[model samples]
Target: MCEACSSATRGFLAAGDCEGLTSLVEEVEFTSHWSYEDDSNNDSTNASNDSVRNRSMVETRVPRYWSWHQQSGEGSFVPSPDLNGWMLTIDAQNLSVGYHYRLCLDVDGVGTMQGYGYTGVKAFVSPVKATDVDLPLPRARDAELQLSCPLGPSGASAFLATSCDTTLPATTRVTSLGEVRTASVPVLSAGSASACSVMLDTAHLPGGRHFTLCVGVAGSGASLGMIGLPALGDALVKVYVTPISAFTSPRGHGVVLLGQNEKLFITCSRCTGSSEVFISSGACFVGLASANSSFKSTPTFASLLLGSSSQWEAVLDTSAMPAGQAYRLCVDLDGHIDSTLGPGDSGQFVRISGVLAVSATGLAASRVTVPLQCSGCSTSTAAYLSSSCSVGPLDVISGPLRDAPVSMALDGMGGFTVTPGISGLELFRHYDLCVDLDGIGTVSESFFSGHSVFLSGLLQVLGFSTVFKAPAQPISLSCSGCIDTSKAYLGLSCGGAGGFAAALGATAKAAPTTVIRTSGTSELLSVDAALLDAGKHYVLCWQQYEQCGPGMV
Candidate 1:
């Protein structure tokens, strides 16, 4: 079997390098960064100025071509642009009607991944994706890792081998009696996935994070890993063996939005012995000036719909859960168990960033926030946020904004603050207090969010505690190394010595930067047409609107 697969391929290198665990191979998809090639590489199918538009200008972008088989016996794929990546089919020379073959992305990371190891945590029948959290092994309990071959026939005895030392095939080591695990398990049927779970003797296994699990099927002798697809590669999985037992799923990017119901599938392998399963929630975060106390919901018992015991699924009906409030997920096994999910972190929770309402009433723009949850969305769905009031440039106040003593002064200690004499400050926008101090002349120094003269910093900052709710918003000054250096507010039109004028000069871009990478004034070169007022003809050019100044012109 090894010779047949070896003859079909050579030098199959894996992609990506995990930071610490160097022995194991990552099982996720290699990222597919896609962009259309220029005219030199165009296949006549390309269109001129082809622009793909979704609902809004935000939240959507083009996708890459999917690669179903970068390494195959003889494969071909039709370009699947709509799917965000290319889609392809593998035409293996050795694939029979009733045999299990390991399919993979070929390499790892973004470098050159080609295949997926026929591996997943042996918890669900569908082989759920592995979590970044290390599979915690209690001092006494044994954890299970799966070895599978979906393209293989029945009666193929499978063996599992885990190792701390890399560079050697566990299948080869097992064949040579090199202390690799060799076990045989039953096969379900033809064309059915032949899977076996080899228990790890925790005592014999080195008690640390970095380890790799290798598997093989015994046919005419044993083939390391899966057959056919990955060519001659072994089914290797990276394991982070830890003394700290933990809940694995729902660990990363727990985005919870408002007006959405979330169902979480909770599983804990070390949690099998407990008779009853319970789920609990708690406020997971608190920042400065937060009044809310640490909150933990009473653990509510849940009836398990499925699972042996440890691997039970607890459905979280978070319909009534507070939006925009991050909450930690807990197993609630204090009285029932001897082991606790020690310092179980946000891997057990979700973050909400949904804004319920944003308004600019009078001189204050108020914001209401909730969760930014996703329903039926995978963790790969990315999110972007820019906190500000106007999409255009700061509405430079023209009029003497207010005729009162809204004086801004360099206090004796160089402290920057906004007191409650709030006059006609813009509502619901973020404003950087542009200032001119001694050495640094006219730089954006102090920044305050949530309703200030520059319409307060931001309406409501995402992932922050309830904003410092007050009439005069507190402006957190970030003037580094500044100590009362003749400060003057730039163009704010307050009774303070600050005033906005033409000296507030040319930024890289003009008012309302329209370009994405708005690095300079050239971004607004988007204008195309100009007509002559005399006969409404296309104007050739325009002369300078003003005369030169002094000798610098």
Candidate 2:
């Protein structure tokens, strides 16, 4: 027998396996190192030096090996050789089911190798349980699902399934799958780990309906669990309407007037597909027709179908409505009332014939002019200025003359101007100036209603005198007929045959004359009539020295 065969047979006999002992000897061959690296120098010493370093490193390192065994009682096997010659062992009792693994070897002298046989075993994979799930409202148009499961040797994946039919199972409509990922760190003491989350875009789905959601692994589908969400309403779309203004009657131009029937033009933002548009005026509702529609009716009031454009025009009749009554315009969409677009008096009719503004004019004895502005007032409307706001026996100031009739001149643009000449008016005195619209209505609601405006600071002249006497006794006298009291003096004269003569000198007359001063251009004086002849015709006079025209007696 060959020397290698004899040695193998003897080893088998010693191990008590001599009955089936078979021996064979073959020389092992290895590829030359020159094929892996350049050895053009043919230097054996360099090769020997490299081998020595590698061998020393292999000897100092601790060896590790992977052992795989079959749990079906097929015996254990170390499929890979250890670089440091370490021994490997496998116990079948610790192996699990439904898992397969292979061994890898890193030999010191040889290259890396893989085991030819695979070990199949069973592993305990905790059932996938959905810890929590969150889905957005139907209007939000998005879906999200979260789940958790036991950390298995191979981590699990999750997916989201949605169905429009709430009665059907969600798994039937698998819309999206969770991304694959490795086993994550344990989140709880129960060894439960969070799986990959699932997300779905629901923007394309119709709103206002119920939907079902299911979370599960890729292979398990929705078997893990399922949830239901209530029906959601559609998202709100903002709506806005432009302001409406009255239109001119014959000219058909836009204007603002009170209690006048005129066409109204309106513009708005189109937010929905509804062709029927309704406009609300306070508690009243009116159907509006689009300007482009062919529907035609009486010019008093009519409606048009709104076309593709956002503009709408209609005729409003205010013959039956009172002046100063405000109107509100509101839009209704699919039974949804949108009041935000309509503010107070957005479509109010023109109740005022014209607006009035009063201002003072002139220097001393001042005068005032009132400007009445009207956009689309009737030609028959009459405007005038009045002292009182009452109706009967109106105290109206018509012209620049004080006694002239109160009247306003129309500027042909629904406006009027009235400049009243107020003479003999007391300075610094307030007089109410009001504008009355006779045919149309009172412009009292305007800002210029009966405003107390007048000019002041004018010079005035006045004179007065009083006499007091006791029968058969001395008579007392008082006089006020001077502009400057400092220059004023009381003069006395006794009746004489030729004429009355000065009874006292000017200096002596000042003693009896008590000058009383005032704020105006007049002065007062008091003197005792006893200073003159009693029971005699006497003349008393108040006079300013240089500025006096004549002394009054």
Summed over model 1, clashes come to 49
Worst 10 residues of 2 by lDDT: 7-16
lDDT of 1 by residue, 352-415 (tens): 3232221211122232111221222122111111222211122222232321212223223423
* Poorest stretch of ten by lDDT in candidate 1: 544-553
lDDT of 1 at 346: 22
* Reference-based lDDT, each prediction: 0.28, 0.30
Give TM-scores for every candidate, taking all chains together and pairing residue i with residue i.
0.23, 0.20
Model 2 misplaced regions, further than 4 Å = 1-353, 356-366, 376-405, 410-415, 420-553
Clashes of each: 49, 21
- For every candidate in turn, the CA RMSD to the true structure comes to 31.3, 35.6
Query: What CA RMSD would candidate 1 show?
Result: 31.3
| Predicted structure with the largest lDDT when compared to the true one | 2
